[model samples]
Target: MSSLQFNAVLLEISNQLSAEQLEQIKFLCRDMIRKRELETIDTGRKLFNILTERGRLGADNKECLCELLREIQRHDLSDKLNRFESQSGSTDNQPDDEEKAKLDIATEVISENLGKSWRKLGRKLGLTDVKLESIYKRHPTELEEMAVELLKEWRKIRGAEARTEELIKALRACQYNLTADKVEHRLATR
Candidate 1:
């Protein structure tokens, strides 16, 4: 999903929220949003824009919003968001042949350089602990394969939002700066 699409989703979700729920969201985000600013805001779109501007919401990251929805006991809204994400992936109609080839090469380079830090990168990429354990169990002695599998799983979950930049960010977050640079250089030179 693009930021525009993500914003649309957030707006749709915000429209569904009750006034009390909006206040609750503002309260929950007190630390990140200033009290004066919160008082001035009375709409979900504004709050979402602030969050997005702060890097708290995006196509590659929706955890905060999802958690907020769940915290507010709005599982239905959360599900609505998730459904949009999954369907957006399909509507994107898959990558072209060239993009697919580039992704394959990038994945190969990332998997090899990732080494034993695959799990850390996986966690940073939003893979659950249980999913990481399952991947590990499936390839106890194969580091490269484990890394590739983890990347594949992440790609599956992220779908259209799965970009090389997001992978680079996750790699850097896991302290794999060299690997991230390599990935960026590789994609650039391609």
Candidate 2:
């Protein structure tokens, strides 16, 4: 199926959702989508747009959307999404072998080299301050563990939408250029 078909399906699903259901979705996605942004999203199309822009929704990754549907007790919608995936012959949000390798390398490089700036990187990657503090408290003086946990938390929240490129971009944004470069170099060599 084409993107047009996928979008049409989303639009149909969005149209079926009640206003309260939309609010539930926004609430469920609070970790990935900012509260300020969520407040402005009064429509499903806009919500989907934000999800798309934030890398939470795409042809290659629909698990987040499906999970949100299930969270809201909308199994019918989730089934619809799954049907679309099957019809489109898309993988169930599984990364290809090369992408998986890149993500693994990126995770290792970022975790080891993140150092004392893990919180900053987390913030740059859209993790909340509360979440960062929780992570810090968990590892306390173990910065490497904290970094690894931070990345793991991010991945958990992002689901299949989490990509090595996104992590590298966050590293660059947080001024961890060398770490980002290391990820890029490792990915390139592999």
Candidate 3:
């Protein structure tokens, strides 16, 4: 969603909250979006996806969502949403992180298309099949936590985007270096 639409959703949800609760939510929201840059919340990811066409925030709490909108400078939408609520109107649409969570497996990671191969990432992360099996055999919870941490780190690293950009640069460079050795001979003969 656009920042305005997102802010409207947040305001709608906040209308059900108390002043104290709102303060807490705001603080948590910031923590979710900015504080825990490496540590991600499912809500934050979902919020980001929605905005970025994947459908996704920070602080670690609800209020941080509002803080995020403000950080992006969408106060106008926040104002309009709250105003609309006061006028006995309701936004019908709201963020459904909880519902989305229920629908999902809760273990989805971000892009890996250009990142390491799954087997390679598993080895690099020290969570290889053998390693994971060993951990699960001795400590299920430990394995779970390790997997979660690795996924969080993956979310923070834009490996796929970086790789794509690198590929594009390389392609452009190749376009300028079109003098193949065989082609050069043909041109010289011409």
Q: Who is ahead in lDDT, 1 or 2?
A: 2
- Residue-level lDDT of model 3, residues 73-182, one tens digit each, is 44433343434333333333332554333212222321212122223343443333543343233434454455444443332232222232222233234442222232
Task: For candidate 2, write residues 1-190 as lDDT tens digits.
Answer: 6789889989988887899999999999899988899899999999999999989898778899999998987776776677666645644454567666777788888888989989898888887776687577668999889998888767655655778989988888888899999989988887
Provide the overall lDDT of each model, using Cα atoms, as 2-decimal numbers.
0.81, 0.82, 0.37
> Which candidate achieves the best TM-score against the true structure?
1
lDDT of 1 by residue, 1-190 (tens): 7778877888888887889999998889999888998998889989988888888988788889888888877765676577678778776745566766666877999988888878888889888776687678779999999999998777767665577778777878888899888887888888
Model 1 alpha-carbon drift over 4 Å, by segment: 1-93, 96-98
Q: State candidate 2's TM-score.
A: 0.50
Model 2 bad stretches (over 4 Å): 1-97
Global Cα lDDT for candidate 2: 0.82
lDDT (0-100) at residue 147 of candidate 3?
Answer: 45
Task: Compute the lDDT of residue 27 as modeled in candidate 1.
Answer: 89
- Return the candidate ranking by TM-score, descending: 1, 2, 3
